[model samples]
Target: MIFTIARKEFRSLFAAPSTWWMLALMQFLFAWFFFVRIDDYLQVQAQLTQLANAPGSTIAVASPLYSALALMLMLLIPLFTMRLIAEERRNRTWVLLLTAPVSVTHIVLGKFLGLMLLLVLIVAGSAIMLVTLLLGTHADLGLMLANILGVLLLSASYAALGLYFSALSKQPVIAAIGALGMSFGLWLLELSASDNRSFLRAISPNAHFQNLNMGLVNSADLIYFMLFTATLLWLTIRQLNDERRSS
Candidate 1:
């Protein structure tokens, strides 16, 4: 039942022309950033060749690329997530979904899963540029894989939160702004805080992703992302339930 709903939602995303245009814009941004970063990395590599060998040289070489990719993904996710529920509500289609035989939980999970599937496509597309970097270069494949996984998990978390916000608003434009504002604020909070307040860092997906960006697979970070995504998804279901009952 959930898969049926998911399929419907996933197909709806592609039925619209705007989704394709947004995806194309995102791909162009990623490709442009990749080219600039690769050029910068090559220049740095040439300089490093003349310098003494540093400890953990391989990790050092890969960190910049991972960092750049992570930044690019952070900016792209909100655009995809903004339309998850808000647009449906705006178009009067959410009521139809609410009146369906499926439970609110099923609806929320279905939409979430649909967005996640689309995210996989976006991430896989961006990965082609990263793979291109491996040609004639000494890149750590394991580290790169870990970074990609981290980005996916991080993007999922953001998508979940954005979807929740989308469900909360009937206005898609408001949902888009709200999602971006919330994400940007969370990023700012994590960046402004000190390590002594690391407990607060657990609340920010970007913070957990920072560990992943460093090629460190901490169990705590993985758990944080899972819990964050699950919690927000639950909230979305609850919101749908409340809205349905009120209607």
Candidate 2:
């Protein structure tokens, strides 16, 4: 039953012209950045070779591109997450979902999963550009895998937060603004604070993503992401239940 709901939600996303337009815009931005980074890397190849006479010099050369890609992802995720639930509510489709035989948990999970799946495809598509770089240069497979995992986990956290906010509002524009404001605010806090605020840093998804990007998979970081995602999902479920009861 959950899968059925998820399939419907996933299909709805594809059917929506706005979703495709956003996806097209994202792809264009990704491609443009990729080309610019590759071109910059090529220009600096000579300088890097002069500085380091190492076997993995090409991998070192590609580090800047990876960093740029990560930054772009951080900016892009919230936009995709904005409409997941808010649009349904704004269109009055959420009432239909509430009256369905499926449990609130199932509905929330199904939607979350569907968004995650779409995010996975977006991530995978961006990765193809990275893979193309590997053809002529030696890249670290393990490092690349770690980067991908970090991206997925980071995206999951954003999606969960977006879902929660979507449940809180019936206006899709309000939901998008709220989600972006919260995400950007959290990111800014993580960036602006000193190391003395390590406790606060641990709570930010961007902080954990930094560790993952460095190829350091700490269990604590994984747990933080899991807990963050789970808490928001639970909040969304509660919100749905409360709405149904009130209705």
Model 2 scores what on Cα lDDT? Answer: 0.78
The C-alpha stretches of model 2 lying farther than 4 A from their native spots are 53-75
Give the TM-score of each candidate.
0.91, 0.91
Candidate 1 backbone clash number? 0
Give the least accurate 10-residue stretch of model 1, judged by summed lDDT: 54-63
For residues 1-247, could you state the per-residue lDDT of candidate 2 as single tens digits?
A: 7787678777877887877887888788778877776776777777777865643523453345555555665666555555677777777777887898889999989888988888888889877877876788877777777778888888888889888888898887788788878888778777876993576776778888877777788898899999999999999999989998999
lDDT of 2 at 85: 74
Task: Give the residue spans of candidate 1 off by over 4 A.
Answer: 52-62
lDDT of 2 at 83: 65
